[model samples]
Target chain A: MALFATCLTDTFYPDTARAVVRLLERLGCTVDFPLGQTCCGQMHFNTGYREQAKPLAQRYAGVFAGYHAVVVPSGSCAGMVREFHPGLVGASPATTMTYELTEFLVDVLGVTDVGAYFPHRVTYHPTCHSLRMLGVGDRPLTLLRAVRGLDLVELPFAETCCGFGGTFAVKNAETSTAMLADKMRCVLDTGAEVVTAGDNSCLMHIGGGLSRVRAGVRPVHLAEILASTEEEPWAAIR
Target chain B: MGSNPVTWLGTPPFPKAAHAALGDSQLRANLRKATGTIRAKRAEAVAELSDWERLRRAGEAIKDDVLSRLDTYLERLERAVTERGGVVHWARDAAEANDTVLRLTREAGADEVVKVKSMATQEIGLNEALAAGGVHAIETDLAELIVQLGHDRPSHILVPAIHRNRAEIRDIFRRQMPSAPPWLSDKPVALTEAARRHLRRKFLSAKVAISGANFAVADTGSIVVVESEGNGRMCLTLPRTLITVMGLEKIVPTWRDLEVFLQLLPRSSTAERMNPYTSVWTGVTPGDGPQRFHLVLLDNGRTNALADPVGRQALRCIRCSACLNVCPVYERTGGQAYGSVYPGPIGAILAPQLVGDMHDAQAASLPYASSLCGACYEVCPVRINIPEVLVHLRAQATAAKGSRGPEALGMAAAGWVFADPKRYEAAQRAGSLARFLARDGWITRLPFPGSRWTASRDVPAPPAESFRMWWRRTRG
Candidate 1:
């Protein structure tokens, strides 16, 4: 299986890439990144710059030319590749194929867990793209269930958007803050110390809300949780 | 909002109402609050079902079948309605529909008509049309009355007065209702009674009522109005002349189709297992309900919309508020931004489809309204890929002869760059280099429509290195 460490994880959040790679390798897959790969053109496509999105599509197609399947850590990026790519290209043949991280971990790889352990009262925040766009329902939950000693408490309104819709946060800041407050209330309701999700974008929004409210809960990515075990930082404690 | 098109939100392809709506902050806030609540609730309700995708597919199939054979079902419905002693009127446009209803009211010798909360009526501006014909159309639904009396256009699809908080509602009731109790508080009960009192006499005395159908069942010649309150029942019954105006796309071929929509609509929109008061009326009877039943089938721009294969699928909309509830764009700016009777995700697609892509900022801006989030698609009772349709429309708008300069130039250059990988790599390298030169991580300034990108949010600067470059350095 090949992993597409999305531009975000590759650049700023490198630890997330390491965790994704580590978790996949433990699941017994030969993870590879075709060096020729670039961005998914999601930003351009979403911003109504369809023309700008096309090159990224062709570049992605060109880079992932011979790969069997491409998995990305983020549902948004993966959705851009899977749903938007063919759409942007529109009958122009492109060989690149992709799946969201949790989806590939559950669907193609058929492994719910990579034999990791994290004993904590944590809740899952379903990213907007993960829940609605990619429709990656329960694939992450299926993996989380396998973790040894993980409580996996459910977050209230887990499926509601945390209002960090790419440029939406700045575009409609007041309404965005209002929605984030509602999401925060739901998160705080679960009494879970940590909020886990498949995408970092959503995590950052929720984490920012937590920071603003000075809430005790922290946001963690699903990749990091899956990549942890008894020998790692998230191992069972005293 | 200005008289000229200079301050228009988009190119001169938008309808008038959308352009006007941009300036109304109170309406925007009301819409934002109402749509936000519904959108949140929809997610909660949808998540409970394990086979949501299957349900969406089923809904899509039912609506598609109905829309494809719409002519047949409509004919069957008209025949069934006539057989059951209900007069059927076919309207070619909003003018014809309103004229038909007003003429019928005059024929019935009724001066006033009680109204159900119907989006079609709003779309056609039926109340104002009736007023022009010297007929007073009184809205009986709680939220609608607030909007009607306040002289406000509805923001959200489901809760028309969604923009109003309880206190604002109380103020509207206190100021507008002649029979209002002087101590009407912001409490829900107080507000309800105030509206009830204001509308009670209208419902009892009004000899005619105009409504829009949630679904027009062709098999049974039935018109269904799904709502949370019983006020619809008052509008459906009581009046001697009950006229149900419907969009041509509101038909379902059979009871099985109704079954699929029933499951999808309520869950997707109001977050209920089923609508509380789903009044199903099929023509008239000896002494039951209305003595005079009239069904007006409205085809205002629907056939034109249907002619386009890609866009015609939007006709399958069940008027379920589900799409409105789950939309992020709707959650923010609220439903008023689309500047049509229809707002939110459906409005973005449907407004352009129902009304011709007009010349103004509102109509032109409607296609680009969404972030292409696809939440509306997920929540739609009928599985309309709203995002796909939006993108398609945007492309259409962009490709039109009137394409704007900045967008056209950018898209043209993009077409060349995107058509090749090596060219894309060069562009990315150039972009990254430009970002380095700019120093500031986010681009605060932009040129023209690119200015819209920087209008609110930071244009995330190109990173120091493209992922491909980093991959090459590490892998090589």
Candidate 2:
């Protein structure tokens, strides 16, 4: 299996990518990181540059063509590949092989318990793409519940977008911030030490707001929490 | 008078308009309260049916079949209505539709007409057109009446005064309605009673009435209007001459097909099993209802919209406003920011297409107003893939802007870099140089385009090494 660490995770949140590698290896699966992969063309495709996105989509298909399974840690990127690649580059073998981290863990591996440990009060926010696009329902929570020492509190209005809609945050910043403010309030209301989601893009927006306000709450990726164990504990990178 | 009233002239682009709307705390509060309440109720109402998904599929299929052969269904409808003692008028655009209605009102020799809250008439700016022709159009629906009385644009599809709370509404009534009681309170019943008493005289005295149909059954030549208030029934029955302006797309082939929409519309819109009033009329009825009836089938850029294979699905909208209620963007910015009568997720896709001018900056910006969260698509009764259509429209808007624009140049540059891993890694390493400006691992501010992001949210400084660099160093 190959790991498709999305462009956002590779640049600003490299540790989240590392966590995925660690978790997959620990689950007794050999994972390959394809060096030729850069992006899934989601940003370009979504922002009205379909012609520009074509090359990236082609690159994605070529780089991961023969892999038995391609595990993507981000739901939006996975959706871009599985749902949209057919329209852009036609149906490639890699498109069907690609799976979101939670989908791969639960459906492919058939394991809810990954033998992980995290001793913090954490709330789970279901990102819009993961919830609605990929339909990764309760799979992350199902895994979190089996973590030996973790408390998974439900986020109020967890289905709402965190408003980090790629260029949308830049183009329509005020409206984006208004949405982020509500998401931040919901995260704060949980009173949990950490807020976690499958997609780091949304986490970055939510965490950016929380960090700006000095809210003292950490926005951690689901991979980092699942990768943590008694022998190797996950520490805050920031 | 030559200028088209249908155009949202001088309205700023969506982002600029939304920026102003975001500052209005009162409007924000009203929108949040109303949409949130409806969102919950709609969810419960939809959940009651075990076969809701099946019904939604049927609705989509039925609408698709109608749109596939719209000309046939429309001709069949025209013939049926003509046989039943009604006049059918084909309007290629808003100007023609307005002219037809104005001529009809003039023929009736009535200066004033009562309306049943039709989006078609709103799209055509029919009232303004009539007023220009020395005729008056009185809105009879409570919300439409409030909007008309307040001299305000209709902000929502179902509830035009959704931006105004009860206190604001009371003020509008007190200041605008001459018939409103001096001691009227802000209570819900009081507001409705006031609007009812004010419109009753107009309903009794008006010789001509106008409406937009919810569904027009082709075989039966019947027009359906479903409403919570009974004003639609009064307008349909009381007037001597009735004129209905309908969009070309609001047609179903058979009466049986109407059952699927009847089940979907009310629950998805008002969160009720059935609306309080559903008035379905077939042409004219002598000595029973209106003596003369005119049906204006409006094209008004619908054919242009229907020409696009992907965007044509927007024509299937039942106007339930379920998408509007669940939309987070609409919940915050309110409807006026969209600069069209159709606002929220539906407007984001529909307005740009109906206008058919992506070069128009305001219409172009509509597609970008959404976050592409897919919330609207999930809630739509007719299953319009709003996010898909939004992105598709954005591509058209981008093409219309040409390649010389800043956004286009940036996108082209990024596309070049992303085409190869070597160029992408080089760009990432260069991006990490911004860390020199970082304080405590975050870039609090930046310039131009980046400033837009850092205006409200902090940006994380790029890591020292890209993931590929780390992977090679550790595993090599």
Candidate 3:
């Protein structure tokens, strides 16, 4: 299996990427990181810079060509790879090989419980791309439900976008903030100690707001929580 | 005469308009309540029909069929309407459409006309044009009347005064409406009663009526007006002369096609099983209704829209405003920010294409207003790929700009770095230097464009080593 550690995870959330690798390897898979991997070009494609996105997409396809299965930690990047890659790089094996982390675990690995444990009251935000684009319905939730000692609370309006739409967060800051405020309010209402999502982009947006107000609700990647165990706690890594 | 252009003249770009709208706490609250309530009901309404997906597909197919053979269907409609004693006039643009209506009103020798809520007329600036031509167009729809009374532009497509709550509407009625009883209250029933009483006078006395059709069937030459109130029926039946200005895109091929739209529109727009009144008319009747009838088939940049294969799909819109109710941007900013009669996701695509000039700053700024959340597409009964069209329009707008200078150069430079692993690694190393600026592992603010991001939220600190670096060290 190949792991496409997205640009943000590679640069800022390396621990999350490491968690995915740890989780995957523990499940009896040899994880290969295509060193040549870079950005998914979602920012470029979404911002109407398709010409710039094209080459990056082609590079991505080239790097992960022979892998039978490619796993991605982030939902948006996985959606970009699965949904938009065909438009950028044309129909290819690479397009069909990509799977979001939860989808791979539930569908491919066929495992409800990966023998993980996370003792926290956490709410899961299903990012828009993961929910709508990938249609990764209940896979992440199913995985979370199985974690021993995990108290997974359902997020209110869980399917709505967190408004971290790539460049949209920066370009349309006020509206984005307004939406984030609503999402944060919902998270707070759940009274959960942590907020978790498949995509770090949304987590970053939600985390930023929570941290700013000192809300005491930490944002954790789903992979990190799923990678958690009685011996190696998820909290220790953060 | 007020010409057939949108009422919004000198409309600012989206960012400026949105900035003003965002500051309006009242407007935001109204939009949130209205949109949320409607959307919740719509979901329930849709879930009640198990074959909704089938209905949506059928609606989409019918519209696509109409668009593909629009010329054939339109000619068929003209013949049918003419046979039924209706005068079918063609307007190449808004100016022509306004001229047609003005001439018809003048022919009827009426200074004032009662109007049914029509987005087409609003799009063409008909009331403003009519007012300019020494004609008073009395808007009979409850929401339209509120907007007209307040001297404000119509905001939402279905509910023009959606930005105004009950209290504000009561104030508008108390201030602007002469017929408002002293005992009128801020409750919805009281507000609607005041409007009904006020419009009743205009309905009975007006010699001419002007409207926009919801669906104009090609086979029957029948024009349909689906409304919550019976205002549309009064405008159609009570007047001596009637004029309907309809977008060419509103045509569906056959009378049977009404089944799909009648089901889809009410459910999607108002979350109703069926609207309170749905009036359908073909041309003129001697003694039964209006003695004279005029149907203005309007182009007004629709031909320009139909010229592009991708953009033409937006014409499939049933004008349900389902997309608007589900859109986060519309909920936050309200409809006025869109600067056109059409607002929300549909407006974002339609306004730019209808304007057909990306250099026009107001139209161009619209395509970027959304977060590309895809909610609009999900709820769209006709399944118009609004997000797809938004990105497509963005590309067109970007191309029309010719050169973005620094932004273009920046993208190119970033593209270059991303193409090669070594260059990408080097760039990552350079970016990681920002760790020094982190306070407790989060960077709060930065320069220029990054400042835009940090203005509302903090960014995480770049890790000491990239993931690939960590991988190489451990694996080796």
Q: Which pairs clash (backbone N, Cα, C closer than 3 Å) in model 3?
A: B1-B129, B1-B133, B2-B128, B2-B129, B4-B124, B5-B124
| Candidate 1 residue-wise lDDT, B60-140, digit = tens | 887777777778888998898899899999998888888898899999998888999988888887887788889888988
Report the backbone clash tally of model 1. 12
What is the per-residue lDDT of model 3 for residues A37-138, given as tens digits with 9 covering 90 to 100?
A: 999898888877887888888888888999989999988899998888898789678779999999999899998899899999999999888888889988
Q: Candidate 2 chain B: minimum summed lDDT over ten consecutive residues — where?
A: B1-10
DockQ of 1: 0.19
Better of 2 and 3 by lDDT: 2
Instruction: Point out the higher-scoring one by TM-score: 2 or 3.
Output: 2
lDDT of 1: 0.74
- For model 1, residues A34-133, the per-residue Cα lDDT tens digits are 6545567775576456767777787777777666778888989987887778867753223246878888888888887679888888899888788877
DockQ of each: 0.19, 0.85, 0.77
Model 3 C-alpha lDDT per residue in residues B1-476, reported as the tens digit of each score: 11325526677888778888988999999999999999999999998998999999999999999999999999999999999999999999888999899999999999999999998898988888888999999999889998999999888999999999888899999999899977779998888888888888899999999999999989989999999889899999999999999999999888888998899989999998898999999987788998888999999889899998888889999889999999988998999988889989999999888878887878888889998889999999999998888888887877777655666677778888888889988988999999999998889989988887788888888888988899898884
* CA deviation > 4 Å runs, candidate 1: A1-32, A39-62, A84-97, A106-125, A138-158, A162-238, B1-57, B255-257, B267-276, B287-289, B401-404, B411-467
Model 2 / residue A96 / CA error / Å? 0.5
Looking at candidate 3 chain B, the ten consecutive residues that score lowest on lDDT are B1-10
**For residues A1-238, could you state the per-residue lDDT of candidate 2 as single tens digits?**
9999988999888899899999999999998998999999999999999999988999999999999999999999999999999999999999999999999999999989999899999999998899999999999999999998998888999898888888999989999999999999999998999999999999889988888898988889999999999888888422
